[model samples]
Target: MWQQKTIHLAEKPRGFHLITEEVLAQLPEIKNIKIGLVHLLLQHTSAGLTLNENADPTVREDFLQYINRLAPEDLNYLKHTYEGDDDMPAHLKSSLLGVELMLPITQGQLNLGVWQGIYLGEYRNFGGVRQLIVTIQS
Candidate 1:
């Protein structure tokens, strides 16, 4: 049997953070086990996942700004009440955005584009721990 561990993204993200490949790398395998699918789920309500540019920092900044503009924080929608104004907007942002993403795995790694990088989008004002579920299969 082959098994891997979950990597926790511990931060309230504003941009893309390049995680080392060693974290997701599986151990030595005696037999062949092809990964058919990858499931990445964001545990928090205000956070989501997106595969975006990994090469340029400015691109990520621009992306973040763009998403924020798409669903600006200060919109006056009183559907979901919360402690702070950003809370409801955050959920709304997630709704406008998404929660989970599916990526195909090839060569024992995530088959992301050249500039694409996996990001855990956090709309919160401060840092918090976000758990990602990575399930690999044949």
Candidate 2:
């Protein structure tokens, strides 16, 4: 079986946000698949998707801080400056972090580690609503 859907995520500020529950909430059909794979694609160039620590909020904060250092918006070499200061840096950060994720599904639930959860890396200061294309295959 194969299924696909596009879901809109609420706007978020520049930071790393835990969105595992949000994604699951939008896909109740996932419970019907005992074994499968869920593929998530963030349909934007200024944001990213990843799996990481869910037990602590500080981990998300640290992620935002570290990522900003890796792709600071103050770089004078950026040519894509028409959007804004955060625009070019957002693209750089998105490329480094990526915009897709694939996770295993088992026993009618996501087979993520105990401390693992899906994260949305909101690279832009005002990224607004984000769109995600979720595909499930079993």
The number of the candidate with the highest lDDT is 2
lDDT of 1: 0.62
Question: Model 2, range 1-85, lDDT digits (tens) per residue?
Answer: 9999999899998899999999999999999899999999999999999999999999999999999999998999989988899
Cα shift from native, residue 39, model 2 (Å): 0.3
**What's each prediction's TM-score?**
0.76, 0.98
Native-to-model Cα distance after best TM-score fit, residue 99 in candidate 1, in Å: 1.8
- Model 1, 40-134: lDDT tens digits are 66667876766677787787677678777876766776656555656776776677667777776666566678877766667777637777665
State in Å the error of residue 70, model 1: 2.1
How many steric overlaps are in each model, in order?
A: 0, 0
TM-score of 1: 0.76
Cα miss at 130, model 1 (Å)?
Answer: 0.4
